[model samples]
Target chain A: MSVNARTMSDDELFYGHKACPGCGGALVVRQALKVLGKDAVAALPAGCMSATGFNFPQLAFANNAMITPFAATASVLSGIEAGLRAQGIKPDGCTVVGFAGDGGTADIGLQALSGAIDRNDDVLYFCYDNEAYMNTGIQRSSETPFGASTTTTPAGPSHPGCVTGKKDLFAMVAAQGIPYAATASIGYPNDLLKKVEKARDIRGTRFIHVMAPCPVGWGFPSSDTIALGKGIVDCGLWYLAEYEDGRFTLNRDPGRFASVADHLRSQSRYRALTDADIVTIEAHRDQVWQRLRQRCSCESS
Target chain B: MLEVIWHARGGQGAFTAARVLGAAASADPDTFALAFPTFGPERRGAPMRAYTKIAARPIGDRSASRRAAIVVYLDDTLFADGWEDELAEGGVVLLNSKVAHPDARVVTVDGSGLAADILGRAIPNTVFLGAIAALCDAVTLENVEEGIRATMPAKLHERNIAVVRAAYDLVAGRARADALPCCSEAAPIEGASGEKEREASSVVSAEPPARIIPQLQELTVAPERFARSTCFQGGHLVSKNAGWRSLRPLVDQQACTGCFNCYLLCPDGTIYKQPGAGSSSTVAIDYDFCKGCGICAKACPAHCIAMVEEGGGRDEALHIRQ
Candidate 1:
């Protein structure tokens, strides 16, 4: 695939807001806001972004920003767009975006998000996946990857990190047969921005799953957030892909994928994995990405 | 018996000040003071009230103060909301102000200025207690200092002691100045541009503020008591979120792979991805929520993203991502 297109355009997000040092979720929200621009109204659930960005006393959005319930992010976003439509405001004039962390998207917000997708609601749903319940002190979420340690899934002699792998969130969303569904990473803003622009333009349940590396939750050096995001793709643990019009496209093909161990080296969360475990994880990664590639190819053909 | 009411935004130490006042009053075997806060959100700048009751004997009545012997305004802006009606007819008002109110009984002190200069931030609660100690003969300065010292950390005792002394001297000086007929009206407050800077700096200056104060709207007349709050917004905050940051993340396209990793990895979702040519598109960062965690710089396998010291120097670690 081609790389490093052009510089991103300026938008409404400004400085002087709060996020932790090296927050990947903040980057995802910022870029999404810019792509959506002044016309966008975002409904965010209780998550890291809500705690940091939509803080008390002030909010970061220049546009309307609503704080919805933990499980109602997608539902509230759908309601906001529906309310606007009921008031005779064209959907095109105002973009409704639902933002939630992995904990919200994969766990608590599943039913609401599923319902929104089922209804084919005209809204852009962005899930900035940090892989755990970061806002509530690094607890394990449904999206927490296997061989990673969280507060709830603490690595110990008997238990080695999370026993279960991450929920296949994109597949779940795409299975809904939405108009647009894609996977993105904060490490590559241009690609993520392109996906967002494409999703919002396509209309009807656009779900973009973004990989936001959390320094605090992921147990990595704050500065290594972007690198870890790329590491997951390079290791075949994660793949960048898009699902549109029932067709699949592999966004980033790692000709020679880095070993899963290489990806794990940077994250302390994965420190519990033994050499044998890494081998098992690598095999799992290959099997998953290989199937994903086959599905993309079959759909494209 | 003495009834004192404190008017403050939350987090400015009004509750703590009232607690300390009560604690100090309790120290005297002859008096007892009951201090508690009203039902208010824990937001930083939302209008909050705390009451302190000191009596020669233990009082049984536990109602809110209808008439106050002394009203302490932790912020001058609260004056705009009107505190004159909360006081007893002969009550005196102690305020954190550079200029005096229209009334002769109104006493002013630059608590924020003193707090910033002394305590290194704006916390006028302790300063107000010191002023009350000076105005009221009931509590000794030693007792007030003891209360402040006991309530605060040992390290803060030195600065808080300095704050109390400074406030004591300030009100004493102002009292002497105002006693003169020529000085009937207090000299006009100076350089009032920073009045917003007076309280605890939580969250102030909302971007594209729709209303100066949030509109308190009722969705239904007969909603549940808990459901009465229709908005998710917290109380007013004077603290700026920006001051929490130390570094910022920036991107370099030359070494970029357009993999969309950083766009997805941002914890705050501040990265914007715009589709251009499918392979190589454009992306932007929203600094408002960036928080400079540099997850992008770390996540970029292409080494295209870098972290720079926020409002500081060029970080040698920031190489050209290309």
Candidate 2:
């Protein structure tokens, strides 16, 4: 391993994993392992990462990995932390990370995750948001954005795809008043690593929401995995911001925002969008941006 | 280079067929291949699609296949539901049905029932792979056999091989003599020739009109009302209202174990378990909500689920995998 590689340690923490080519979820775990190092113990749920990380004897990780229920990853991590503390095993340099998808975070696992955050548990909670429940097939979840098509909410003559907007998860997590909560994306690996490293030192609950792109689910080329993340942020559909004890900070300066049409056109899920639909999406985007701007301005002063 | 589209129900071996075909193409030094599924949360018996592209060059436009040189209908019932629309003019259609059809050059085989009979399970994907090899001549039986061995477990390898052989023999006997004469004796050459051929074909064919309608009035009202209905009354309701537009999965109670696995795993939450007096009860899948991802059958430990044909459910349990 090179100097940077050594820092990101290639030791199979999850071990013997099986992920598709250009899987963004797998990349998130890989990058997280690099920052947390070998001492980290990840509690994964029954998602793509979990399936890929625990393939029989061919485990994918070099550190400790435990598979947990879909909606109980946070609870499992809390138990693991308590168990280690009981054994007088101070996780001095070790970190406990709870990994789950958007469905496990914003929907099913939200209660347990909120409880963990409310108690200020000394753990890192990472929700790799691929928009929908990708592992189970492209179905609309709470995190699924408006106007996007999924297997369940298909865009047709009458139906206009997912009419409901994505649940405000970052706001919900921020409301917990955790020590640190930030939004990251696989597109910016260095920034993602920086947040992970920062979260490693924090004693209280540190939440990092990563926007991971799914090629199969999103109807994009597998090669565009990294680009989609960037596109999401660039389109202002997903804003990169952080909260430290209710103090919000905008990470990426909102430059000249691109049209939502440009972003929607790049994805197959949005292929059915009409001009009127595009206009509707643009209006929604502006409203969201305005709200985010107000929040950022309020925090800065 | 051949662009192949697979039409099968969720539990059938459409995805496996695509993978096997792609793998076989990969094994040949002269060919490049790509395979992917149009991801859906479809359950067993729900119509699903998977695609494969074999070329002599690196593949481009890696998206859902719009037109295909070879259309493999794992279930024959899909024919009535516009399977022909996706097929290229003069394309070969390899079917797994017992009844011979005259619309396109059809190579039919009972791969699903055969697999269930021989393997004590319903997995006909391997059988379809054999049929594809004989009908399209894009990949060889040996290549498909190797792909199966590489993908399947050691214990199940022999069974899959047997299934493949049976399918290959059936298709070989039924394949049209002049269907693909150039492919009969040719060794696979890895190059872009196949992709070029497909691109040329796509260009030659009139481009499909943009799905967007400029005028709302021009938008034709869809005859099917299956998606709009809130509840289904009975079996007749499936045929009456949803039959024309929607594809439904028909479960056989004898083969079903009433396992809640399907209920838990359905992404759309379409599978519902009704309150029963005892543990042994039937699980109902709400067709209104089911997207038909087929992860249920993939997750089924008992291997009892089979995708039924769309519109009509008369030809139930036409197994796609052995």
What is residue B4's positional error in candidate 2, in angstroms?
59
Whole-model Cα lDDT per candidate? 0.73, 0.70
Listed in order, each prediction's TM-score against the native is 0.55, 0.48
- Model 1, A53-153: lDDT tens digits are 55533445656777899999999988999999899875465789988999899999999999999999999999999999988899998989888999898
lDDT (10s digit) by residue, model 2, range B1-322: 4788888888787987798789887887657678998856758889999999876555655778887877778777776666667777667777777676765556667777888987878667777787777766677788988887777678988988888888778778856766464344332443334445457647834663332101112222232322222221110111111222234555555566766544433332335455444666656665543434354554455666555556555345545423
RMSD of each: 18.5, 27.3
lDDT of 1 by residue, B25-91 (tens): 7787655568988855558778898999876544545778977878888988887655667767666
Model 2: DockQ score: 0.01
Instruction: Kindly provide the TM-score of model 1 when superposed on the true structure, using C-alpha atoms.
Output: 0.55
